[model samples]
Target: MCNDSKIHGFLEKLPKCEHHVHLEGCLTPELMFTLAARNGIKLPDPETRPEFSSAESLYTRYENFTSLDDFLSYYFIGMSVLKQQDDYEALAWEYFQKANADGVHHAEVFFDPQEHINRGVLYDTVVSGFTAGCRRAEKEYGMTTKLILCFVKHLPASDASKVFDLAVERGDFDSGVVHGIGASSSEVGPPKDMFKEIYATAHSKGIQRTAHAGEEGDPSYISAALDAYKSQRIDHGIRLIDSPSLMERIVKDEILLTVCPVSNVKLRCFDHISQVPIRRFLDAGVKFSINSDDPAYFGGFILHNYCAVQEAFGLSIADWRLIALNSIEGSWIEQERKLELLKLVDEHIDKHLAD
Candidate 1:
């Protein structure tokens, strides 16, 4: 681990933006209990406890997963307590409070409306709660946020299309606060091409696009997502480096890679944090950003993500600054807002170094 206090200081002060986190995944155990008690929900006993319940243990006990399904099984349980608009509002508020505490200036959070809607929760109710919390965060905490409605790849493409239509009908895209469509969930089913029509519909309505790819699959999936979904960014694209041609393509296209390090360790993607290819990705000049994919389930927020990468990679102050720049480059914010953020990042870095 690195002992460079100077670099650590820079990392903590660097203005940051997150682009790959899930709202449901932000449910901390303390919040989980609060929501459960209020909603009259019950979690399984320890004998049948999901592995992700160990999330409360800082993910120290989740080392036995043999497959993504095993990881997701526990992941599903972690989000089961949410049942109403108040539940969603509390989840969003809690997540932003943590993000604000971590110095996150802007964030693009993913939401799975189907997770609630399939269980009979109203679509308007889901958006109302989330948007209310985000509005409150901006007014109260000074955090800027954007929402992305993500399609569950494990479900049929038709179902995703239906939800996409619902999102548009609800004026999610018209509001500018909800700006994009994303494909997430298990990557094993429903080829990326299956959602081409949905992406097209979203595009026609002026929504931007992104997709999850290359984390647990081959680089070809990344290609399909880009080609079919017309994605502007790739989430968890760590596997792209495995194929030099694909890596070259990513750089040439300027596609941003959103990386979540501690989550990778907890999910057993690599045996050690130092094995993460963050430096390698940077050296290759592939545009990328850092994020805590699921802070609650993975046991860290954006600051922890930065600190973990810094300690594992032994990044220098310059390296930390480069990462902050990459985050600005990858953000979907308007040019005026992005410039404002860049100025803030620069000012923060300068002030910290001078201190």
Candidate 2:
């Protein structure tokens, strides 16, 4: 989407912080097939599920997602290949490698613990693998990383709480192995406040909170998440633009909306990238970050989302700077890392402007 070479380079070099990406969502078709064979997992037959016939076929199917649920059906099947600690580590490390190349300086990635646990995978297996991937990013790229363990909302709140309690018992929050807690999946039917107990526990424990809100639902979902769950940040908060009052409240709170441009388009949330309200958010002074919610499934990574935003709205350098800075500020990082990323944003802008 970024046809202009100058702007493309500028977007590429700007340090980014990804706040909405799902580690499970990062499993590409190639890797999924590889993992399936390695783990002795048998995929559905092509006669029954033609999309799984080949990795290329699945890639083609991903190009036309009918709805969030449609994509999710395939999403769950894809992650079934991830059974071992190494599988999870590979999945996350692959994502980190792609993110690092996209100039992501800090990443707060989401992992669905309830889903894995439901499939009989150990919680330790999932967390340890992802943490290993995060560690690799730190060692090789010197990048800062944090993990957000997301609870699946479609399951009973009790299910989510069980996983949340397990995470707490493991000291995931206190030790920073898991920096936060969040809710995700099937956003429409499940009210955002369904996990009130879990979010309350998280808030009580000083763990950061965020949730998937207003993606497939209305602005009320976003408001409920903020008022009920006390979410510190919002994932896929695109619909908040429709509710001026909610938008104002989010602005007042300095909460960040992790907007995934390409995912919205690919998920059939919008017909095209131009309709995503990137420009509207900018004009309204909404603090938002462009991200890749699920790069493998959504057809693009963080930089691609940035390019799509740039192409859709033709944002100015200052607009880009504001986005990058807001992402840095919204990150669940130590104050020192936040300042470091902030400075990098300014220096990047200055150096590019001078050039």
Candidate 2: regions farther than 4 A off: none
TM-scores, one per candidate: 0.93, 0.98
After best superposition, candidate 1 residue 287: deviation in angstroms? Answer: 0.6
> What tens-digit string does per-residue lDDT give for candidate 1 at 40-149?
87777655655335335525544455556666776676677888888899899988988887778888999987777776778788888998888988899777789998
Q: How many pairs of residues collide in each model?
A: 0, 0
- Best of the candidates, TM-score: 2
Q: Residue 61 deviation, candidate 1, in Å?
A: 4.5
Can you list the residue pairs that collide in candidate 2?
A: none
Candidate 1 weakest lDDT stretch, 10 residues: 49-58
Reference-based lDDT, residue 191, model 1:
73
Best by lDDT: 2
What do the candidate models score in CA lDDT, each in turn? Answer: 0.81, 0.90
**lDDT value, candidate 2, whole model:** 0.90
**lDDT tens digits, residue span 33-104, model 2:** 999999899989989889888988999999989989898888888999999999999999999999999999
